[model samples]
Target: MQITRAQRSAVAERITQLERSFYGRGPSNVKVSVSQDVPVSLVVLSIDSLTAADSVLSARGHREAVIRHHEALHDVTRADFINAVEDVVGSQVHAYLAQVHPDTGHAVRVFIFADSGDSRELDSLDDRDD
Candidate 1:
């Protein structure tokens, strides 16, 4: 499925809210870039980089809950959805780094890069790479 920028913005905003609620403050010194690779049917949210504090936050149990919420919002499921959700949450910590530094130009990307019946393209790049 193709998630629009507006949708992504909404997700980002929610993520920010969640981060604020979970932590007294959001991530600092990092950027979160989210992109959906349609050919792979996957959502890729990259962090500009990481800091010591960011690393610490990622090591908490609540972090797993956050990822579950993220995947649940998108209705994603796997053979072991619970484990998958936890993994997503762990991965998402990096994205929150961007929310903490919005002016840094790193935003998270979400997309369905591949589907059960869709073709997969591994090398087609997006504007973020430029």
Candidate 2:
């Protein structure tokens, strides 16, 4: 099983949309992809410029503090993130894994969907002509 290009784009667009509404403004770039593993649909979203402000603070020797703050911020908004992903994927979100790499000035959002419509079955209903 593989997550098609259509699925990839759909997830990416949703993430981009969330940036403005959730984070004040969209990131510089958002890359999204899906891994076709068994039993679940795993989506990985790489967000650039997500940690920019924190990175600047990190350079001032408060890296740990900034990192902790980032973690707490995400925790506070985790529910909204999960809901957004679920809406785009049209499946129940089983798990949401979020991480920020301040060293790299990037963040990752992974959404694992509880098996909803199987890939084979979703091919027909997903908004893809293929």
Candidate 3:
């Protein structure tokens, strides 16, 4: 289930592009980590806390909203595997927002798990063990 170096590089490049589009630049505190066992790449956004953003998504009754968002993007960018990774990262932002700002109702946190042979999975904030 390990992702190839080329795949990871492609995903990273797409993520960099996505960050520029969304935040006007990569997050100052954003961190990217890759796992070979799960064939997953994690884009962690450092926030002060989760209550501020977490509350929004929770209040909206959209536990898996982040995951769905990423899946949509994944489907849209059929040829670009990196797009899928960006989707997952984008989804995580929302999940993290919800987790950090529970009262704000703006969830943000995107976790992308890529399975063998180009398969990708997105998990929402609620889905996270933490």
Candidate 4:
């Protein structure tokens, strides 16, 4: 299943807005894509140029601290993130995986949608026009 440009833009904007509202800084770049790497299709959201404060911590040899902080923040806001995505995709998320690299100021959020037994090869969604 190919994702529409509007859907991608909406998802990216929602994530950026959430980051800015909660973290006081939004990612400089956001890319949303659908993947078919698993039994169920997945939504992959990649964030780039996150807050510079994280880089500062990494430079000061506090990378672990930054990672921990980000983990805690993700834990606290997982529901909101999932909800934002669900609202856009109209599907319940079965799992959400998030990771942040403090040194690079990049993050990835992988969402696995609940399988309805109609999985489609969506890895090419990013390559096609909706």
lDDT by residue (1-130, candidate 3, tens digit) is 3445565455555655554554344433333455444434454333322232333565677646634543454344332333355443442211111122333322234454543344333233225546
Q: Encode model 4's per-residue lDDT on 32-108: one tens digit a residue.
A: 87775553444545455456777788899999988898899887788788888878877766777888887777788
Over 4 Å off, model 1 = 28-130
lDDT of 4 at 64: 94
Off by over 4 Å in 3: 27-31, 38-83, 86-130
Pick the lDDT winner: 4
Estimate, for each residue in 37-119, the C-alpha lDDT of model 2 and write its tens digit.
75565555555545456767878877787768768867777767776666666677666777777666577887776665434
The TM-score-based order of candidates, best leading, equals 4, 2, 3, 1
Ranking by lDDT: 4, 2, 3, 1
> Which one wins on TM-score?
4
Q: Is candidate 1 or candidate 4 better by TM-score?
A: 4
Model 2 regions lying over 4 Å from their true place: 1-4, 116-130
Candidate 2: deviation at residue 71, Å? 1.1
**By the lDDT metric, which is better: model 1 or model 3?**
3
RMSD of 1: 13.2
- Window of ten residues with lowest summed lDDT in model 3: 91-100
